[model samples]
Target chain A: MVRYLSAALLVASLFWLAGCGSSGVSFNGKDITGLMPDLEFSLKGEGGETVTQARYQGEAVVLFFGYTHCPDFCPTTLTALAQALNKLSDQEREQIRVLFVSVDPERDTPELLAKYTAYFSPRVDGLTGDQETLRELTKRYRTTYSYGEPNESGAYLVNHGLAMYGFDRHGKVRLFMRNDQPVDQIAEDLRALVSIQ
Target chain B: MLHTLYGALTPYIFSPITVLLFLLAVTAYLVGWRRLAARGRPPSAWRSLSFFLGVLLCYLVMHTQFDYYSRYMFFVHRGQHLVLHHLGAFLIALANPLPVLAACAGDRHFPRLAAVLRPVRRVLFDPVVATVLFVGLIFFWLSPSIHFDAMLSLRLYELMNWSMLVDGVIFWLVILDPRDPDRAHTSRFGVRFLMLVAALFPQILLGAYITFADAGLYDVYAICGRAFAIDAATDQVLGGLLTWIPPAMMTIVGALVVLRLYLRYDSEKGG
Candidate 1:
């Protein structure tokens, strides 16, 4: 009975230690830490400056692929992320960067992208590139995109991946946030990511 | 956040057929209970309670957030399947409402009601047929293409749910019938034990395949997208694990019960 009690105490202490362990990042999104390969990208930012994974070193980065014309998912996701970022303290918010990569280069120019992202939050940067560059980046990320057939008015829809990835301070893809996650949960995840360093 | 989650998870539409079926179950139970009491042979409280609980579960699955959120999350969808196929079916079978129902219908002349259902039962309630359907429909509905198609169409989704419920009830009703004279004459326990064993492997294989797959199987979740974000791959894996573990345990429990019954019968005969 003493031996059993010792074993139980040992187990309980181990659990307690685990509960108090490093960087208590309870991600609301799927934890893809070390499961996914390092995400690499180079695109033109809203200000026409070159943007790469290295640019946001030492900060938690959020990357999304969407088009400006997307009727629902794109705006909703951006707004939710904005709300989440707003929930953070200014210092914590400074540790996070959000990149909205436009899948529709034909319409979402650098200026347009800048305007669109600015409407959400100043911290959110809009990124766009030529079709070939965008394709290459999306392929590396395992994201899908395609242009729908043009209508009579010559307007077409671009359907792209509705997911976003979160990278920790070390620049490794650590979380895959679904399109349906609530705003506050996203804020919690962002807070955890901010403390990663 | 929790309120928003709950709101997103609540059922948006009522399924007319499911509601109709639930009403029928309640009416049948009430009529059976009353008739049995009038005859001074009231159905056992346990049986009545089990049947009522089964009907309630059936209603809950059809009309609650369980049904609503199934459209988004793979794990929730698997959960819906488990509730319909296992727990609800088991309780309904244990209730064994057929005799009571017949008593209600035929004014205590259950044989007359049984005679009316005889031909239909002989064809549809064959143990072998039930076993095949019980196992086959699980694979059929869960196959990626079919599941994806069902998600896209409300009609197909309803059909899938109804068929699973019906097949589950039929399979359990046949296997768990304590007083099926035909089952007694035949070595039914041995057959049931074999059926239970046979049902385990295909499910395990399917579950493992889904669990370990590199990519998500269903495209509907990918295309339509969820309201809150969960990684499709991770959700698929969790859903697959859900399918794998619980059903296997249930089958094992069922097999153990069959074995115990077989042993008891053998020991009694030896004595």
Candidate 2:
């Protein structure tokens, strides 16, 4: 029993050394596995239906972490997502859905967020909720954020990792796209990911 | 100054070296666009290199202006600033193109950077940020007291290099960032048109200053300066060209890039 406990302690120390324990993401969350932590979410999209892990299953989804109030990065990224979609052939474009989840739920109401997403692309959907639900999803995606930095204003910024998750038609996470990975590369990667199944 | 400008204007400046370097750049660009160039615009490296060289050429022009001004005529100095900041800066920026580093790095490094920038790239790449910075820098530099200070102090010479070389590169990056929504959100017609106009202002101001100044701006280029066979009047015209011609070429080329982008899409209205 003592030997087994020592082995466990050694593994735990390794994880702690790597800093994954301090991360808000599930310590068990797999970075390369095509599986997001099966969290339930309600996206204000497509007739305002409640979206969950099952709904995204068997569909290709491109997900982003952002807020409506973001002047530079958030809105621009959403637009690029839209443009990349638009660049695809009709068949390819039809098979994909872009999700914009607001990290700031305090101000980004569903209706306001919906309006912002609609301006860029109709196929784009916005998601937001109370802190509890937001925290749950952010954990599953391994996204990190903080409030009120470099100033005392109510304004806050998210310093989350900027990778796009590509879930195949199986709803399994298949690939990750780094920020500004070029329109063509993302498009080709998506095509390959979708064609896999 | 007139003699120097004359020497620069002669054929050697536009020699086979320009063409050879441009062609070498073309080859590099071809390699750069391994995927897209075949199908779409063959993203031209020649154009970008030309822009880089144009900025360097303007740096040389500033050298001449410095030589002209040490003797105390202020108008030529002012004209030089106008040239370097707006005209020279924009043309250089437009010509050099943007994210050349991204293009050169290829598929692997790009994704990592993209991931890093995903949440934050837009802010750094925003056209408005560059526009505001450039406009603000010019606004600050244009203040009369500042102008007087730049003329009197040796540091303004260095500062001019910063505004023209550094700030110039950044502002042009935005104006030319085709993928940047903050920039493209303007819609091509208005954005490109505005870019040209904003680019043209400094050049126009410089010519007006030189032509209208009551006394010569630089002591070095005073009436008593060495009389060249070409004469000072002709040299001033060369200054105007140095300020205006390269920018005009850049703008026309920029318009072409924008128009080509628009036309490519317009023709693809199969959707």
Quote each prediction's TM-score: 0.57, 0.36
Q: Which run of 10 residues does model 1 chain B get worst, by summed lDDT?
A: B178-187
Q: On residues A1-197, what C-alpha lDDT tens digit does candidate 2 reach at each position?
A: 44344434533553332221111122111233322333346544434556665666666777777788776767666766777777888988778877887777777777787788889987787877667776556545544444545357666554443557666676656555656567766667666666656
lDDT of 1 by residue, A176-197 (tens): 7878789999998898888776
Interface RMSD of 2: 30.7
Top lDDT model: 1
**Candidate 1 iRMSD, 1 decimal:** 16.2
Worst 10 residues of 2 chain A by lDDT: A20-29
> DockQ values for all predictions?
0.03, 0.01
Q: What is the lDDT of residue B258 in candidate 2?
A: 68
What DockQ number belongs to candidate 1?
0.03
Q: What is the C-alpha lDDT of each candidate?
A: 0.76, 0.54
Report the C-alpha displacement of residue B135, candidate 2, in angstroms: 4.1
Docking tier of model 2: it is: incorrect
**Candidate 1, pairs of clashing residues:** A178-B229, A180-B227, A180-B228, A180-B229, A181-B228, A181-B229
Q: Give the Å shift of residue B2 in candidate 2.
A: 20
